[model samples]
Target: MGLNYQLVLWNNHKKTYDKLIVLGMLLYIILFAVVTLVFNSETSIETLVIRAFGSLAIIMLHIILVIGPLARLNSAFLPILYNRRHLGVSMFIAAFIHGGFSMFQFHALGDVNPIYSIFISNMDYGSLTDFPFQVLGFLALLILFVMASTSHDFFLGNLSAKTWKRLHMMVYAAYALIIAHVFLGAFQQETSPFTIGILVFGFILVSSLHLITAFKEGHIDTAKTEEKEGWLKVCDISEIEEDRAKIFTVEKERIAIFKYDGKLSAIHNVCKHQGGPLGEGKIIDGCITCPWHGYQYLPANGQSPPPFTEKVATYELKLDGKTVYINPKAFEEGTEVNPCKI
Candidate 1:
């Protein structure tokens, strides 16, 4: 939930950076396209590759855009949220390549103006047989360009989160447009009844899975952030052993109470990545290691040490007589509760 867009020294060109990821991805696309175009004994393989890659690219973009909203409903899906923008920008590049190829190869032949030809060539809005399919891709690409241009955190910071969220809602519209593009453009051309049916079935399957997850997660109020509760007695200070933690659920929130080296600290039981239970994780040196992915958080504050940035919210704790009680009231995320009266 914390999006600190502050300028920090990050090695963006590292092999892990999204640009390299997409660049390598596009390179593979180019390699495959070249191999298919060159070796296709039949002449139509090049065009088929273009349309197929184009559809694949747009569908991926839909997945990238929907992940954040999807994660709100499913804890298992948060890793996609943690790493989504890379996928967005990658899809943008794919769409751009697909659009450019379609324009140059199909529309720019002879003396046709590509832009004008793209619009006037297709007007099949009335009937399935006469549908204007190319327009759908053009419109979807436009949507993608707009969204990709503003995908950076700078825009998220400048435009308020709410406004940015609303603006980005164009993704759903783009998804529908691309689906229509696939049906009208490729399915209409290939009409190999079986392939077209398979494509539609695949599309429906992926979309149905997302819809089912969204329906399930829709009941969760992701907007509800702060956990407010009166002090709840958990266990005797003696019952909490060294280097171990007890977890409790209060107000639909899971919290971890830790006892390490005679000190008590409390943090959100869920890992920031995918809600891994922190209480079940072991301590490494001074950091509490997440049980699932080994993401480390300081026992003092939920902040990750140098070289990693993920954070979790921490709560106030006290040893009331021998009984430990938690002030379930949440503090500003990333701040530590030094519960020990040193």
Candidate 2:
């Protein structure tokens, strides 16, 4: 596995904020160079500045769309998913640049109306092959704009997760349009076989990543299937070895019971990341660590500290005389239910 450089660095929230500001400063410099110097000097030339930005925007869109699924397939990609909305907003801003520049360069000027020029004599529409190529970019930008506008957690908190996911799924529709835009707008105009090969090759690479993810998660439904609640418990305080955890199978469910020092901590063995067995993972620095991607959980409370807020169903453990008893009820975060007595 590849080492995560960012994780190894000193983690300070304020420093992260400062880094973002630095990145924004650098981005402004590049955008200024392109919009003012590069395009302004060649406004009258045929270098296709607007179309080039459109291609750039579409490529960024592919990265934004793929990050979430990629993170599921490989937890190492989690950082991208953590800051995904920022990427979406960046992609929308790039698309806005492409769209605005195209509008002015090809649609405005002269004594004729801007509206008439936009729809009719945009020069791109003159060719039979590229007549509707620009429209694909326009429609895709609109979709991206919508998604970017609603990407905040405020929208996610107000709308149900199902509704939010449905709205965001439009990103895929935008992706398809962007592919069409690239094929017709850039490849057609450039007339270079190398460009076509590059575009097609990029598409295959993104699709292959997604296909690999699907294959890895093909048994996800089976993992979630309910287990028959016949035999599960395999312990008591005296039964479990000190500083170790035991796994028990219940209604298709796997649970972990840990005895640390004098306190007993019971938790779901399934890792929240991808159902990796938590019982098999090692305890590090007072936290139970998932062997897969090092996700940690405090078994006594069933709540993760920083960087791992994800949770799984937890059981309530009780000491009846010496035999430990467990309750099956599990609830959402912030619920009033108390975990097993530590």
Candidate 3:
């Protein structure tokens, strides 16, 4: 939201979120270590630290992945989406600890370099059960490091929002590598039913949530809209919920038709910040608030409030009986259009 970037634009909510995250992480690590010691007193402290941090990192990554789809499925999860970057950065820190200690314990002091030993020490690539799974973890950690390093607004501004988003999308690839690392590494060594069940359950839950959300959005994207003259029929006025939007694809671009306060306005669906799905957001204080970051815009003009110059293209909307219609052509950014009464 600025030309020059500071470290962080912290608010009371962000501070409270961060403190809760730190406290929860500390409590989880302590409790995990204590439980491990109680059951297996002979286990080394190094192993305990490695296992504790590794499990914590995996759990955090799962939470981070689920947050997006969960938020899409229900607006109640949007608060978690607001601070997701913090969760990702915290997950990376835990992973870094796990990777560092693992390399030290398993590969250090060898004649070859520890980093080199990670790849060469176990070259059983042809065998799934005996693969050098540490290499998978190393690569995943590298991706996580890059993503975490660039999670700030400074990088987003310098890299351009599209490029930044594509780079961060590598998180899915990193998640896959991490799954392979755990399956071919830990699960192979520890063939306990409890461990396998937990891994299977996590994989199924994360995959199912993403699939469900994708299917729901896919239906919306493929919806057919009838065009008459120059106006496109988006939906019935009754179909749009109050304070929410009905999104439609028109002329290769997405349009968000929001019904609010007994009136309707149309704007481009993409948010100026982060290209978030603005149509999925609900109107608050008479402005369309972007779901990802809470960027707001007046629906009539597709412009932010004064002192904030961000704007999106607006569309001319009309009503015929119970049907809602929008002109397929878009107005220039920030152009004002009268809201059609509901």
Candidate 4:
């Protein structure tokens, strides 16, 4: 939420979040190194460092993937979702360290380039046990690097929210590749069944959470309303909580009818910042605040406050006794639609 972009808008919240991330990462790496040394005194420092960072990256990625669905399931997790990009960039750093050391340790002394050697040196793709899994890891790292490089709002603004979101959605692909890399490469060499089982559990957890959240939200997309006099009947006024919203899908567009300050106003459910579900958010300081990033907009006009240029489409709302109805058509972005009195 800024009129102009600098490197970072370091507020107290961001500063605190980043500090926690750094401390957590450092603590994990140190604990990993210490535990590995205590258990396996024969393990070389190089191998230990690579494994520590690689494990950290894997854990960070799991956390990153889980945060979205967790937030969807419960609003208490929204605080964690606020600064996820910082965690993403930090995860990339750990992954880069792991990949860099791995490349050097395994292929640097070869006659050809290390990256080239990763492919040519491991041509046993035909063998499942001896497949070239490093290639998968390298590809995943490349995708992460791309995402990390463009994590800033400058790129988000330039690329447009939709395009930026699509680009970042490549994290799922990267996750799949990393899973293959771990199972085919590291797990093949490891003897511990418990370690492999933990990875399986993580995969199941992430997948199950996403599936559950999606299934829960699926009804909202498929929801249909009765039309009366060119207005779609949304729901009983009692269904909408004060300072909250009830989202309705109209003509393939999701409209959020907010109940605040003893009146009802309808606006596009999609937040301009990152396409977050505004319907999931609450009215804060008389503005509809996005749950994802706290981008605020006036409930009456669907416009961000002064000095902010973001806007969302406003829809007409009407009240018939205790029932709420909304016009199927939407006004232009930033159009002021008078709120329906309760």
Candidate 5:
């Protein structure tokens, strides 16, 4: 929503979101430390700190991964998606803390460089039980570092939306590495059923949500609609709620047909920023507001309001006895099409 590159301004909602994040992280870490000390009185302080932060990071990563699919499945989850980057950065901090402490505890005492020690400290990669799991964690941390550093709109603009999305998608790789790091490293020594159960539960939850959401999205993408005179028939006007949208996939593009002020307009569903699902958003302040980042565009022209230059392709919509029809051919970005009155 900014015309120039500058530090992102924190709104009241963002401030509250960040406060919750900090509070939750602090609470989790404290509770972890206390629980570990009570359960295993002989555990060292260094080990407690390492495990606390490491476990917190793992939990945060799970929450982060679940947010996207959850949002897609139900719009009620979109509020969390608004400031997900904050959670991501916080997760990286926890991970860095864990990795840093572990490096210092296990490798810093050796004559070789600490990072070098992670590789040379363990050469038994052939054995599943004695593999160099820290190396996997290190690589994952590096990927996370890249993502967290470039999480701002400045980087998104410079790298382009596609490139930025692809880069951030490295999260799945990082997740795999972290999973391996946990199983091959900690699980090798700790064989508690509760720990293993938690890991398995998290993995299953993340995987299942993703699969279900993917299937839903795929079905929508491949759905068939009646086409007449180069126009595709969508649902009736009553299907869409006021200020909401019903998305249709046409010509390999997802188009959002929004209902507001007793009128209908169609625009590219993909948000110009971060490629968010604009169809999932609602009308706010008379503009179509992207649920992901609050990016707003005029339904009449697919253009952002004055002082903003972002735009999306528009489509011509027609009303035939309460049924809506859309031309698959898209107009140029920011092209104004007269709305179809209800």
Candidate 6:
């Protein structure tokens, strides 16, 4: 929403969200340290800080990963999704602290550079139990640092949304590296069954949530479409929720048919901002809003309001009894078309 670069477009909501996150993170660290002290009185402060921050980072990463799929599964999770960037940046900070402290405690006094030592000191790649797991964590931290550094809208605009999204998608690779780091490092040393069970349960829960969301969307994409001449049947009028859209795949192209104000309109399902799934968003202020970044387009025409040049292809829609149908052929981007009356 800026012509040039912007560090951040902060608002009251973002301030409140950030404050709550910081408070929660501090509380979690304090509680974890207290519990560790009670259980093992001889545990050193450095070890406690390492474990506390490492656990917090992993927990934050899990929350960040789940927010997307959870929001897609239910609209109530949208607020969490909206402020996910903050959570990601916070996670990187926690991880940085853990990494810094570990390096100081274990490798700083050595002859070689600590950063270099992280890689050269751990050469047991052939053995799973003896592998240099610190290297995995270092690489993952590097990726997270990159992502957090370029998380602003300025980066998104300058790098182009497509490139930015692809770069950010490296988080999945980072997550895998972190999982291996934990399993090969901490889990190998921790003998508590409770800790092992929790790790396994978290992995299964995150994996299942992602799989369920993917399958649900896949079913929608594979839905049968009835075509007559140039128009393709979308769905019954009653099936579409008010102010919301029902997405359809017509001839390999995805279209979003929205029912609002007792009328129907169709637009390309992809948002120009980040290729976000526009169909999943709801109508706000009489404009079709994108779920990913809140970009908007008028329903009657696929163009954004003045000062914003974004646009999408508009499709011709028709109503027959209670059924809604859309022309398979899309008009040129920003083309104006009348909304079909319900």
- The per-model lDDT (C-alpha) reads 0.71, 0.64, 0.91, 0.93, 0.93, 0.89
Cα error, residue 65 of model 1, in Å, equals: 6.1
Judged by whole-model lDDT over C-alpha atoms, candidate 2 comes out at 0.64
lDDT of 3 at 285: 94
Better of 1 and 3 by lDDT: 3
Error of 4 at 130 (Å): 2.3
Tens digits of per-residue lDDT for model 2, 68-144: 66776666766556566666787687678788887677667857775455555556656767566767777888898
Q: What does the lDDT come to for candidate 1?
A: 0.71
Order the candidate numbers by lDDT, best to worst.
Answer: 5, 4, 3, 6, 1, 2
Model 5: per-residue lDDT, tens digit, 1-342? Answer: 756899778989999999999999999988887887788889998888899999999999999999999999998898898899999999999999999999999999789999999999889989988899999999999999999999999988888778999999999999999999999999999889999899899999999999999998998788889988988899989999999999999978899999999999999998888999888899999999999988999999999999899999999999989899998999999999999999
lDDT of 6 at 55: 88
RMSD to the true structure for each prediction, in A, is: 7.3, 8.8, 2.2, 1.6, 2.0, 2.2
Number of backbone clashes in candidate 3 = 0
Instruction: Quote model 2's TM-score.
Output: 0.59
Model 6 residue 94 CA deviation (Å) reads 0.4
- Residue range with the least summed lDDT across 10 consecutive positions in model 1: 219-228
Model 4 stretches astray by more than 4 angstroms: none
* TM-score of each candidate structure, all chains considered together: 0.57, 0.59, 0.91, 0.95, 0.92, 0.91
lDDT of 3 by residue, 1-342 (tens): 544577777899899999988998999899998898899889999999899999899988988999989999998898888899999999999999999999999999989999999999998999988999999999999999999999998888788777889999999999999999999999888889987888788889899999999999888888987889978888889899999998898766888899999999999998877788999988999999998898899999999887777899999999999999888889999999999997
* Model 1: how far residue 187 lies from native, Å: 0.9
Residues 1-342 of candidate 6: C-alpha lDDT, one tens digit per residue: 545664576789889999988998999999998898899889999999999999899988888898889998997888888888899999999999998899898889999999999989879989999999999999999999999999887787788777988999999999999999999999999868887777778888889999999998898889987888877888889999999999999777789999999989999998877778889988999999998779999998999887888899999999989989888889999999999997
Best by TM-score: 4
Question: How many residue pairs in model 4 have overlapping backbones?
Answer: 0
Q: After superposition, how far is residue 266 of candidate 5 from its true place, in Å?
A: 1.1
Q: Per-residue lDDT of 1-342 in model 4, one digit per residue for the tens?
A: 867998676889889999999999999998998888898889998999899999899999999999999999999998889899999999999999999999999999879999999899889989989999999999999999999999998888788888989999999999999999999999988858898888899999999999999899889889867889898899999999999999888877888899988999999999988889999989999999999999999999999999999999999989999999898898999999999999
